[model samples]
Target: MLADLRLITVQEYHRMAEAGILDADERVELIDGYILKMAAKGTAHASAVTRTEQLLRQLLGNRALLRFQDPIRLNNYSEPEPDIAVVQIDPLDYADHHPTASEVYLVIEVADSSFQKGCGLKAKAYARSHIADYWVLDVAERKLHVFRSPSQDGYQTETVLREDATISPLQFPNAIAIIRDLLPKLRAE
Candidate 1:
């Protein structure tokens, strides 16, 4: 990191948006104090996100609130919109502010083209926030990368589950998610 590099705080980021410096339709997120452009979502990415959201909704049934591509407050310097965010239901539905780390149950990133960023920078960011649980769905490989046991260094436990495997959020053990259900079915060529 450059010693002299300026880092933008979350407040400044919001101010930039409110001032129209950052357009509402811009595909960018504040990460480690820098605004990073997000990768374009392809069909596989969109489908996987939809499938995961739909299945989680069906299984969770209001036990948790799910937000797709919505910003989650990680810290003063970083706010990223995970592909799917499983959060605690608030009476206000977070109308006043975005869900913070403590309010989040699970953060899922569909890795269509940003797998490295998801498992790397984002992982560290989430771990540092003590978010508890993070998942990266590798659409191309048809695998689910689970990150748990968050620490300042990053997730202590990392597991890669194939489509045939299953998982459940640490917060809601009863709401099990079959890995296959979260991924798009492979179409025959």
Candidate 2:
């Protein structure tokens, strides 16, 4: 007789991560029954995420919420750490529990080596959970890919934002961000 494999809950996954058992630089996510290592983010990816976070914090002020590279629980089946997430309000109330898709206003993934995974797998997960908006910061292509109108399948609306463009969150009608100003500054290090 064959027995079915046990699926780990989102809570269990967090306990392991919080215990500091995983390496500091490890890129990991709990998908299905296993803990998987995601593709290591490159410098461009890191810089782009940083720039976006800074800009978002400045523009939003204390009006909205912000989280950098935090785990978002899509459901019982998946929990992936997105690059940056902008929520409607401060989330300090939920201490250990991961923020569900309903808690998020927008999810941004700054992509370099993990572009495909971020754009594909993560997009689907966010969509299924009814996340209002999703953005993939394409560091290599130097573009911002916006995803909206999510369904069970995925986003029905997708667009690539160029340097001259400004992108705004659908949740906040008055808020807007300049793409050119938000892009990662080229630095020799």
Candidate 3:
């Protein structure tokens, strides 16, 4: 029943994806040296990601690069692909290797079936690596929980955001995203 039997490093995982060892059709991701079978994107999950992406792309413009479902190298053992990641401005950064946590400005995981995993496991991993910011987009709840100020344990700041709220990146001063516009079909009630 297990698709991946061998433990692979971050580098190896990328190489495998690069070499077509795993096809695009395979719904899977590498996390903490283990290949995890990701749940198929339900309707709600896909909608959230789509709306979020549109808002982010327009807000960030040319200042930051927007990546969707891309693998980010956390470390030797961990390289989990977040739903969306705003990375540093670089033209050739992803040419030879995946972006490290140091290169990431923010990571967003749109959680549907993997809500616990995103809020718990991935949050800890991002924090341990000193990731500047992380957001859990709760599809079921139609809200975003922002996490920032990484410490030895976890993120120092945590805030819940609704559709009417505005979100600004910790790394970028001028960039702002309106939560309501980002969730077009979401109802606050």
Flag regions of model 3 displaced more than 4 Å.
1-7, 12-24, 184-189
Candidate 2, residues 1-189, lDDT tens digits: the string is 236777777777767768887766787887644677877767777778778888888878887778877787788878887888887564565585767778888898888777787778788878888987999888777788999999999889899999779888887766788886667775641
lDDT of 2 at 80: 80
Per-residue CA lDDT of model 1 for 1-189, tens digit only, reads: 799999999999999999999999999999889999999999999999888988998888988999999999988999998899999999999999999999999999999889999999999999999989899999989899999999989999999999889899998899887898988777762
lDDT of 3 by residue, 1-189 (tens): 466556788778768889999886888877767787887888888888898898888777888888899888888878888999999877795887788899999999988889888988788889988898999888777678999888768888889998678888888867788776555374543
Task: Give the distance in Å from residue 74's predicted Cα in candidate 3 to where it truly belongs.
Answer: 0.9
Q: How well does candidate 1 score on lDDT at residue 93? A: 96
lDDT of 1 at 105: 95
Clash count per candidate: 0, 0, 0
C-alpha lDDT score of every prediction, in listed order: 0.92, 0.80, 0.83
lDDT pick, better of 2 and 3: 3
Minimal lDDT window, size 10, model 2: 87-96
TM-scores of all candidate predictions against the true structure: 0.97, 0.85, 0.85
